[model samples]
Target chain A: MKKVAIFGLPLAFFLLAAVFLMRGLYSNPAERDSTLIGQPLPPFQLVDVMDEAIQYRNDALTGEVNLINVWGTWCQTCAVELPFLTQLKDQGVNVVGLYHELDSDPAFGVKSVDVIRTEITEMLKTLGNPYRFNMLDEGRRYSLDLGVTGAPETFLIDKSGKVRLHHIGDLNQRVWQSKFARLYSELESE
Target chain B: MNFRSFLIILFGIILYSVSHSASSVEEKFSFEDESKRALFIELGNELRCPKCQNQNIADSNAVVAKDITAKVYELVKDGKSKDEIISYMKLRYGDFVHYEPPITPLTLWLWLLPLIFILFGCVFMFLLSKKKQVDISQEQLQKADEWLDTK
Candidate 1:
């Protein structure tokens, strides 16, 4: 009985606690707050992947309604959505990208360098470098500021540099049709 | 309680059960070889379910992964090699499909952590065991002296 109480009870408590913690993380934020929507974009500088001497920063784009896609060459989901994002951009949707955690080796997970390089090259060939000026932040400082936890997350920053809309994961043709239309209407109203 | 009546009642129950059929949408794929099925599951457990992004295919609730697994069951039942199926999946979904993704220079830490932890645990356990196995010579001598005095 003593052993059961000592071992079983704590084990049950730990399991319950873990379940709750995961539940909380998965849940959306209770309140809808977009304080950053109208605020100036954060200052950041990153080395260009194409050239070592070329550095890109947010200072270059002072005021433009741009889409900053948080993506990585190593992410499979990012590759899945890359073509759609390019299509949207081709349709004249103002879009830029913060190549989150590029340049440096991925911190977690196991992926062969040869495979990753091949995938990235393929991605570049298809996407045709979507960013007006792409920047790579290995530490993910900018991504965290926008509350991005995953890749293929898209942030729509209006002319004022405030994040207007945040979309997570692959934006299919159907989703882009509706979402981008709404973005356009919102811009016209302003 | 009568034999004739009891048989009639049993037949009626059977007819009712047969009428209220459970038509499952689930596809039936049976395997003759136990080892192949086990291997499929072992391979399944090593692949991440694309729909349930965070979980291994075998551990996910995603119906897509379940469908893929059912397909794998069918193909394996039809006698496909393990390497062939794994390569097929990798081709379709990239290297992220592998649950324990191959350790590359970038992913060195994933492989290194377990080794480091085991080494640390061994050293810790060794020190703990040494501490536990104390020399009883002093305690025995003192107890013996006390016993002699009491006598």
Candidate 2:
């Protein structure tokens, strides 16, 4: 009984720790809160990908519900989400694409900024251009301010310029039909 | 050379190579003021990269970390105070971006768990030693009894 008591305490502690560890494994880190959600878009500006003359600022998204998608040509998932974005655009959903410049790594398959833009244009032509105007986040200053950890993240902004939702990962029809479309319509009514 | 001597030399070579490579690749950032430069370095060390999760912004090779390091440099240049800079990151990225998270009801467990574990460990060790001492004393008592019986 004494031996059992001596070892049992540590055994119980180990079992408790194991339970917590198992619970942690089930909790997805991606489901974490965006501190920027419900807050106004941070002051940022991005130049147009196609036209250097055009610039997009936080004010540009004001007075309209806009879906700001942070995307890059290098991200495989972004390419997959492109068609869905185009479909949303056809349905008159205000979708703005922020072209985050990936590093000039051969592994990413693109080399220069010019090539990236050319490829984006080509992709748009082939996949169908959904973006109202693609904004070039050249230095990723805007992306950093927007708290984008990776490419293919989407932020749904309300008419008041507040970010309604921030989603990380590829957005497809099911995502649109399930959460985003309903939320967008709710904001439109407001 | 002995196996032990070879292992020591191998460790030395690895350490020297790592330090040499680190020094060669380290990116240098220029700040207007000396204090601002210090602050920039401090911020880099303090801020955790959201993407890398493990590495600080200064050491992380991830794209997000690079942007954050640049942003920190920019903020320092703009004459924003350290608190303001931290607040800026916390506002966007939440508490995960800062190495030192604020004390709140939600984070109480995270802060107190370590202290609780230490206390438990101390008590466990104390009880373990006491039990060992009691066992030794019991053995000593048995030996004395046998000695007396034999006598």
Candidate 3:
């Protein structure tokens, strides 16, 4: 009884630690949720150029080749990637732009929300309208669901709402020519 | 062994204990920069490690916080800027890595609240201890009255 009293808590704690170690070893990031890829794209209601409504967020764009590009007007890298995104838009691909909170612009120094209006207006003025539709995420309500860390993340969502490719930084021509097109065709068949 | 020899042995033991304690803090993590090292150790003593709740990094047996503290020592040795080191730590381990509970306006209350509570507690106990019951038995009261008049 005395031995049990001394050893019980330590033994249980050891078991808990072992469980966590096993989980970390076996868990893979790719096996995460991909519901947004193949299903109806989520609603992203944002104000566009000339104060027009942009319906970039909807359930309709799912089960097709769609690119959800994460950007903010404040981020230098995102601005640099704008010309490349414009080219992808010209290719008749459904390139959807998800504006990060605080506009990702260096000037929109909110340190918090990089919302849609700032991103759309700023980019439209400089880079021209590369996106067929744009959504305003003023509060970044949906970004948390998208698993964003650093900005300029691009997720290639297939027709089934399954994410086929998740790129961290820029979406350059070399990336689209090699990886993006192949993934696009793969999703088309599915 | 004379009395002087015995005194010398006792003095040696005292010296050894002092050096041992200092060296333990040193051997764990040592830096060339004396001022930053002193600040790190002083800060380590005051700020409780979030990973090891009961103890600060200086006091903890935690491997993660210990590695971080050791890295802080190394950076201080290398003359890396303090702000850069702090931000690097924040990026790698999140804000919880900093033990010094940052001096924000909202957090001023965390440090102030407990200190105020302790001061009040001490004062209340002191005032309670000073309370004395009056000796109000008839003979005592008469004696006290007589003594007061005599004085």
Candidate 4:
């Protein structure tokens, strides 16, 4: 038994190290459990993207299950996911666009509201509009509050406005089915 | 161009670029007080950029980093303490936002594993030396002495 242990111990450690490294090779560095999961949506009162007259509060997202998609016209992935998001919207999923404006920074020269509206209208017209109504995250303050790192992130908010899931990449059918669909139904049932 | 002049030009360009990039971050965030400015800089160094892994928020030019920096400046101006600001960030972005990870059950292994490895290595080395000592008996030593005398 001592001889077996002497021979086997280093081999066991070698195997463990090999397994650990192998798992690291496949593990995604960008993927992390969101701290905001199980937390309610951050309070914000922002105007609509197209119409400044209409304002949306955090309470607007309550009373229904919704997907708050953080997207910008400048983001390529957002355009790619637009059709799929529209499909989800068509299927009765409450899809809300949290419009993340890239040029909102005054130092970098801010775009006029009319110019932004025109751009959004053009983009949404070309690609199918998924959003019931897009909330303009003015100066990206709301996105910061939501811990949004970049565009094409989605937050799955339940009926009570609690964020159930925060997906960092573009939303598609596979991701929806695998990540969002079951939890969505579960939240609906609740 | 001559080699010496070309080298000088290259060095000048590098210096200019470095100074230019440094000025960009400096001009963006400013505080009325020196302490607030110091706190802002410290927090920026401690906060990890969520978009770009392996870079602190101060070092990254990512939009998210800029947003966080802006927020940090706002909080500092509001008289929020460093711990309060860090916890506020942690609340939204998780422990990954900060450079110093919290000691938790899962992360405790990171600190413990290295110590455990050292302890095992020390034990193994001690046992190896003990085995060597045991293998060389007094009889073997006397035999070696006798053999040397005979030689």
User: TM-score of the B chain in model 1?
Assistant: 0.51
Better of 1 and 4 by lDDT: 4
Question: Ranking under DockQ, best-scoring first?
Answer: 4, 2, 3, 1
Candidate 4: misplaced stretches above 4 Å? A1-3, B1-24, B136-151
- Cα lDDT for residue A6, model 1? 72
Off by over 4 Å in 1: A1-35, A109-119, A127-129, A188-190, B1-151
Best by DockQ: 4
| Cα deviation of A6, candidate 3, in Å | 44
Task: Tell me the TM-score that candidate 1 gets on chain A alone.
Answer: 0.68
lDDT of 2 by residue, A12-112 (tens): 98999999899999986666578888899988767898788888887999999999999977788998998989898888899998888775543234577
Q: Model 1 reaches what TM-score against the true structure?
A: 0.42
- After TM-score superposition, the amount by which residue A116's alpha carbon in candidate 2 deviates from its true location, in angstroms, is 3.4
Residue-wise lDDT of candidate 3 within B36-75, one digit each (tens)? 7776766566444534545766777643345556566666
* Model 3 alpha-carbon miss at residue A126, Å: 3.1
Instruction: Judge the docking of candidate 2 as incorrect, acceptable, medium or high.
Output: medium
Candidate with the greatest TM-score versus the true structure: 4
DockQ of each: 0.01, 0.62, 0.02, 0.81
lDDT of 3 by residue, A54-135 (tens): 4444564565678888776767888888888887778777887776655332433444333445545766778756776655
